[model samples]
Target: MAEAQREKVIRKIEQHLRKTSRQLIKIDTEEQALQYLSDSFRAKLYCDFVGVVFVEDDLFVPKTWSGNVNEVRDTFPLRVDHCSKQLLEHSLTDKEVGLAVDECQLFSLLKKAGVKTWFTVPIKDELHTFGFCMIGFLSYVPLLEMGKHFDEFGQDVAVAISMTRNREMQLKKIEGIEWITKNLSIDAPFEESIEEITTRAGKGTNAEFACIYLYNDYDNCFIYQPPSYGEMKAPKQVRIEHNYILKEHFPFLEKTGGNQMTIPISMDLKTIGVLHVERKRSGVFMDEDLQILRLLSNHIATILENARLYNNEKENRNRLHFLLEYQQALVKETVKHEGFDGIISMLGELFNESVVLFDRFMRPLTYTMDREEEVLIPQLRAEAEKARRKVNPHIVLTEYSQTFSIWPINSGGDLLGYLAVRMSGNELNDYDQIMIEMARNICSIQFIKQKLVLDATEQAKENFISKLLVENVENHESILQYANLFMWDLYNPHRVALLSITLRENELEGCNLLEQQAKKAVVWDYIKVFAVEKTKEILAAMFKEQYLFIVPAEKGVQEFWPQFYKDIQEAGKRSGIHCDILLGVGGKTDNLHDYYASSEQARQALNIVQSRFKEKGYAFFEELGSYTILHQIDNEKTTDLFLENQLGPLEKYSQGKNMDLIHTLRVYLQNNGNAKSTAEELFIHRSSLLYRLEKIESLLESDLSDAEVRFNLLMAFKLYDMRGKMS
Candidate 1:
């Protein structure tokens, strides 16, 4: 009968062991494992009180308990020093069966809680003892009365508990291996793997909440909330410097909150963010549970890292493909399509961003924004300019969450403009830069091709005109026919002003050198429209190096002349050539032959200005008063006189080393007669500058308020600038 009972007990223990093992396998987190152990032990062990106490330092702290367990767990402190020396010694000696029942502090507590018999088992893994599991029976049965049955029951329970733990450890190892294999595969997205990690963690541990907070280096914050969670209940973002989560917040775990067990998730010594798990039930964690969480954490980290790399690689490939296609399309297309609009639309579709292309001046050329009108085009332009000037190319506009890139277009060393693209979405990477360069190359080629075609057509027309005029054999009707052709080709409304510059005889070493230089420097297409409907000598080149060119009057040749002179001077300086310019404005004329007389008068006027202003570097017809008065003004003498009269006192004071006086005068002038403003400007106490000013007024024996006195001082300040004596 006893044998049958023993067999039945063995059968029951085995069944319970299997059930507990299954429960442990379902445990996703440490908290769930604790709860499972507590519940399972209480119901199966037939104990009035069941509790698990984790060893902290040298003391066993109650982590999970049941049936008024909180009362004892809270008040009773189980120190290893105060407990059974026999049991403690046995735990140290025996690696497997660290179970002991003795009269100790825990036993005393059980006695007080109306417990008669108790069994204590050390929950351990391969290495060290993690904690002790206690099962207390309230009955006061004598030791001899139930010795045989007690021994059998106690041994069975210990074996079952140990088996359950072994299974949990084994399962955790399997799960870790499986997760690593699956996550390391190239098919997984980073976010998907992270989600799987967190989800599996939550389910396996039976945690109420499980989250992996990733470190955001850009924001220097933690992103704990997943996208599916519909935004974090916490602020949209939290700074790491302000609200750092520490291990102390988790009371169920040891120092650093199970950090040792969670080393894998913590990333092998680089734990920037936390992987947190919580339970609704109190004391829902065990050392074994922590171990599982730690293992799982490692898998989570690996998966997250892999996923991030995959995402970056994927984005790079996509960007490259988009750029290749866009560039190919640009090269193939010839018509002047909607410049950046089509490009922006294509980029938007390809890169998943609202793109805007701006000109070199920052004006928006084309955009793909939802609210184009609301977009701050000017501000965006300013930002792009500022970024180009002050920051590196890799910088992103964090305030607006936008990125900027610039590309310049040039044809034959002449800058046409720049292409500026503003994109929104992920920050631009190296791949984005490569793609932008590709697009820029395509745009540059197209711009150059179009410019070449236009230049070639204009040159052909110019050549035809030169050939006809040189033959000197065309009749009036033939010349008129060519003029009519020129008028039709140069479509804009135009007027003519003939300019003739007489080169000194033999002064230029090379014949036709000036004309050759002019041909290379001046844009012919721009000049042709200038001579529309004027004279047959629209662009006349005489053998004496005296050239007469008719330019458009209404096309603002007046404004162009100043810049033209500057360009000519620069070109002349570079080529070691010098020539005088004689500009004569002919009245606006519509007929080609009628302006010949006006052109003659302009030539004569240019000669008069050149002869009269022989010593001057530049002589403008408008600057010559009455078109004849050219008086020489000695600028050096004038500068000297002005400096001696106006800046004499300041120079004398500076020579005398009266720095206080010099500073006071400067402040007074800057302040515009306001004592307070002077003091503020000098960063001195108001009384100090005022006192200095009063002393100067007293010493000079002059009323500073007097108009004449102030005027003299102002002139002195002005003269300081002329004399270069301000410093």
Candidate 2:
């Protein structure tokens, strides 16, 4: 009976070992292996408690338990006493060694739970100790007999756990390599690919955080890329000194009891980026984990470098194609001779932006823009002029959040106009700059071409104006024929207006005749263009220092002349020039032969304005009744003699002194020798006027109450004023 019972126990032990081995073989994880070992021990040995205690640091951690002691699983990992740890270490040094339950904290928990007998066997191989397999029984048990079987079972459980872990690690490595290979392509966005790589890296190594940082060559810093799987506590930018992870790089590791690793993503020994992973310090990383990370890093480096080269080539090809297409479109448009407006519209369409063409005066000559962009045209013109003053093409940012790139249309050394583009939400790349430069060159050519035709037309008009002003015409057929060429109605009643511009001392103070003529030529061109644009039917020409225009004698044209004066003054202020502009209008004439008479009258009126030093602005020839006669006299000595005979004494007295006496005499005569009206007009009391009159009478040796003497003095005052203007 004793031999049969022993054989039954041996068969059951073999059956339990075989059952556990089959379950562990099918198991895919470490937790299943541990749980099966605990269940098998409890059922086969009829033990009340079965627990797996794994050594972690200096504590015994109960990983899994079965039977009645499941309630005490959380009670450990308990801090074992020093002697207990020494006993465990010594017992675990050999495969057959057993630990005394009294000295172990794990068994103490089972002892307190009313376990009567308990034993522990080290779950170890020939080379290393894993942990211990502990068993407890509520009733008395034969420990000497079960101790051998417990040790053998512990060995089997250890092998199962190690094999399961190795298998999982190998699977993880294979998955990592497969993921890297599958995602290696330039079709995906660079950021998306990097994010997938980081996520796979984190999962493969079982890391808490994973991140990839790329090196920015311009900023000279490593910019962190967020992972798709988890959040990172690392900073967004880091300045790395080398291609490895330093212990001091992460202070969170020390505080949170974590470990981190990093590997460089490099090309040709130059590190372009780094891959990082971190985990809580429960277990150290294995060689397999590092191997997976290194593989990912190398693959990431290759992808980055290949993507860069591929994208660069693709970009070059696309840019070249874009430029070629633009050139072809422009050439096709040019063949049609579509003018400046057509070119501006084409640019607007090609760039999908607002475009404006401005003349040298910063006036918007043509534009292709929406309503919102039209509202910004004035601002764009202002900025373009500001940039032109800088003498170069550049970018401008306005307060309204608009960006404009202004390119000067320069012919030779002269800036003819500007071509501006509104770049609202994009940066101008190199290809865009090249296209803009090409457009500017095209615009310059177009401007020169137009200027040539305009110059020829202007020369024809200049010849007609010169002959009409100075030549006497006997036959009206020739004059009519010449006027009809410019679509002018020579039979219409028209007025001749002469506009003369004189720069102030600051502009022409030290300039020679050639420099002054050059400046005047620019001003004359501006005036002629302005006149033609303002009134399409007006015939204008620049002759010497004067601008001549034949405008229809209508109410609208009369109103336009005043505004024209204001416009010229505003232009002078804008151009940083202080100038005096005098415009004189002659009488209307219907006959082409009487046009010369109007020109003479206009010239005479202009001469009157020049005679008055303080006078500027427009004057009509009909308004200057006697001044025209005086200016036409053309005898300076006779006027001087008349002034000497009439008020020569007053003139001598006025020298180096106030002209109060002379002014008093002139006022007295203008009031028809009336004292009260003269005093009122002079804003002086009658007695003070009489006192000046008495002094003037004494100096001039004349009688104040004589009408003939007052008349002579009046003519002298008129000549005197005109003489001052001449001087």
Candidate 3:
């Protein structure tokens, strides 16, 4: 009879084992497995209530249940709190399965569920308690005998749940990989890939939100990328100053009152960015979510790598094509047009962007933009210029995405003005940067080409201006035609001003063509009113280390020569021209004949001013008045003969006695023979000056206080001081 009872027990055990295996095989999902276990436990053990609860992020979620499944999952407020965790520990360690309602933290909740007694067995292996299956009864329940099958049933349940979870995770990872592969294209833009990556991550992990914050070493901060999932938005790029604490700056987290999770997206252990997620509950994120996110992150890194490589290769090919086309365009421009205007037009046409060329000194040489943009573009360029000084990249721009990338045009160590491409977007990808850089190279080459042509043009202008000054105008039409070609209104009423510039002796050591051009540019700026392009009246040309400007005279101008001369002197002082600068002006004229006449007059004036020994300043022919007769002589021979004959006696006395007898005689005669004034004029005492005058009188053999003698002595001193330079 005992053996028959034992065999009955063994058969029941075998049947239970076979049923557990069959249930696990039929149920390929964790939820289904949990549901079958709960129902089986209820039927075999005749329990009134049975349920399976899994711990997901500290919440005892009702995965499946035989009784009250809907209420337990939807509204039943029960979780693995600290007290429940303690109870679970006791159940695992002390092998305690049943707990009276008063002794359990879940007493209130269970009472609400209409259960009088409850028993729990931890569904765990050696690693962790994934959850627990709980059984309860409203009537008398057998507790001692129930322990017999409870342990084995719980162990079987744990293994099934573990396998189901692992299988689900594997399936989830596979779906995630497939989703990423399907959504991402290798040749897609980096921004598109970034947007899709964050979206997929959020979906795969079941996160409420997900966004990327790529760290920029240049800005030393993470730049927030807006999630493309909803209406949320962010700056095109923001330089985050805070560490990982972007709460204050990140606007997306402003209304999100929940636990935040930040997973660093890494490639080869180097963190490139971070993925952000949030949940309303503090511990809603589970380990399974982390696993999913980690897998998604791996795929993201690979997608990023593939996208970059594909885009780089495509960009390289496109850039090579653009470069070849750009060089061909440059060659066309060079052969057709030799000025910067053509090159500027070509750049503007190719890029469909504004092109501004500036000298190294920041002076704009040429520009091509819209009428409305003319003012705005320069200001935008100014800001970009500042950024470039800090971060000298091929493409420079602002965070607001107002303008496109600003490229510093450089070639062979020479920096031309920057080339700014007016892209509609904020970031510069490899293709855009390469295109801009290629444009820069083209600009550099054109700049060099334009400079060479300009130099030759300037030399031709100098020759024409020189010829116009001295050559006889036999054919007024020819001269006028030539002047018209140079945009010079020679027929208009104008005057000639010749300027002779001499550099300071100290700065002469390092002087070269560049230095000369620089100095001339500075001086030209100083005399803007007299520069050819600055004023309709002023037309200047460089010739033989000097400048000859033909200034037009209009009605009521009142002879600009005085102001022009004064400006030249001021310019010398401002330019720090320690050496002397001389300017001579001629009277106004209205025809080529008079213009040539004025040019000759200006040349004579320039010669006289430069040849002076005692007087050095501007000499205007109109202001010269009656002194014009003194400059009409062919050479110094006639003036020399007159001055020698007039002062020969005083000159002989001064040489023999080593005294300035002629000067004494001239001073005495000019001061009306007043000894006191003459002595004062010479800064000497009256008595000593009187003795010199007496000696001068002895040498000259002239009567004292004779008006004719005084007149002749005055004339001689004037010629003597003129030093054969009265012309």
Candidate 4:
């Protein structure tokens, strides 16, 4: 009976071993292997408790256990050195005996839980003890009764479990790594790569969650928030700066005790970021698990680096293409034909951003916006000006997902403006920077070219007008003929206003715009808009050199002359453009052929006024003694005497360097007896200019307030200017 019973036990043990072997082979992950050995085979194997304990560097840890596992796990510390030192020491020194505890203590503890006998077998690989497989017997069985057969059977099962678990772990690791490498080689986007890695890692390791953190060098931070989980509430950034993280709040590092594991992702001795995982069960990870995680970390780092490089290369290629297009457009002068708006739009499309072009004064000349303009124009102007003044090559501003990079456009050693490009959610990489530089260069060249063209055209027009004036064909008949020709030739508006010089001597023949000072003043005043309304009319007519016109009045000649004179005087005073005016009145005549006769009469009136008022002041045709006398002074003798008398004091004043007389005369004329404005112009105290004016009044020995005396002094100054020009 005893022998038959023993055979039955042997057959059952064989069946149990066969089933364990089959389950271990089918298991795909470490967690499955652990669960199979602990839960499915425990009771059938005559074990009160089944536990798999992994050993590393003489330390033992209970990875998974059955038979009131929760209670045991909660009661004991997970630390191998402190919790399982006795078992580890016994397993290391004595393989044959295995590790044993006092029957009283072990059996009593088991008996309380409906278990009476206990046995533990050391799990081994190549003669080294990695862990132990433990089983508890429900009925008390004497050691002698179990004998060598029972002990050997237990050892075989433990060894098989350990070997199978290790083999599967290594295979899963290789498969996981291979999958990541294959996916990354295709140059996947960051999000796609991350998703694939995390899913594979989670499934292979039996983890509940997986995450990757990437290093950001610019912000000096780490980004760990994953899209699958939405934005993580945990802080995504860890600043390397001091006082960032307190020691008390440091994250737990033990892999087995906590639900989390953090492994440094490294390549070539450099740590890039961290890979973190969390398991649902407590005390689940072992040393082998950590080894697998470290391997996975290496694979992740390689894949991340490759993805980054691929993105960089792609960006560089796109930027190069954009630069080529920009250069081509600029070289072909397409930018000029398209205008500022077109250029800005092209820039925006090339960079996938909104672009704005500013003028030399930092005013926005053209802008392309992808969205509505929410920011104030003044704010944009202010920011652009600040960037321009600093000459910053790139100024980056981040607000939400948008980033603005402002680049200065420099032309001919002068800052012309800026190019502002707005990028959404991404930083400006090296390729973007290179493209911006190319754009800046192109813009600078185009701007300079346009300015040069404009300047040359203006110069040529001035030269043409100067030639006509110097030929002494600027009278009414000749000017009208030129005006008619200009009206037919030009497309813009045209108007002709006669500007006659009221000389204080018989009229000078060679007086025209050809004189260098007058020509220079005309050009300067044209640029300064000194007489913008008048200049615009002339530019519309001829688009060239300055001119003087003489027009005959048809009616109201008496009333028109004074008003016209006042308008010219005020315009000159307002703009600081110094020029004398003379009006020519003639009887109404519709015949264009009679213009020459009217012009001659006007010249005769101008000559008479120039002689009589050469030292007194300018005179009108109505103020002249008679038309006969005015016509008589067109002789050379009258002009010679007028010049000598009017220019005598100026000659003496110039030779003696007596600015007192010149200043007194200038103030006397400017003040027009007000006394205040003249003093301000001379930068002297008002009382001083007044005293000097009084001295001039005494020297002249005339009532300065008298219209005749004042007129004489003013004419003398005018004659002095005319005589100096002649000399």
**Each prediction's Cα RMSD?**
19.3, 12.0, 9.8, 12.1
Index of the highest-TM-score prediction: 2
Judging by lDDT, tell me the better candidate of 1 and 4: 4
For candidate 1, report its TM-score: 0.49
* Candidate 3, 596-683: lDDT as tens digits: 6777677666665765421546776655543465555566777777776667766666675756876677667768888888899988
TM-score (all chains, Cα) for each model: 0.49, 0.58, 0.54, 0.51
User: Candidate 3 or 4, higher lDDT?
Assistant: 3
Per-residue alpha-carbon lDDT of model 2 for 16-102, expressed as tens digits? Answer: 777887788678788888898888778778778787877766577778889765556767667645326543442232222345555
Clashes of each: 15, 1, 1, 5
lDDT of each: 0.54, 0.73, 0.65, 0.55
Candidate ranking (lDDT, best to worst): 2, 3, 4, 1
Q: How many backbone clashes does candidate 4 have?
A: 5
lDDT of 1: 0.54
- List runs of model 1 lying over 4 Å from the truth: 1-171, 183-185, 189-192, 203-208, 225-272, 280-284, 328-333, 336-406, 411-413, 421-428, 431-435, 475-485, 488-548, 551-727
Task: Flag the better candidate by TM-score, 2 or 3.
Answer: 2
User: Model 3 scores what on Cα lDDT?
Assistant: 0.65
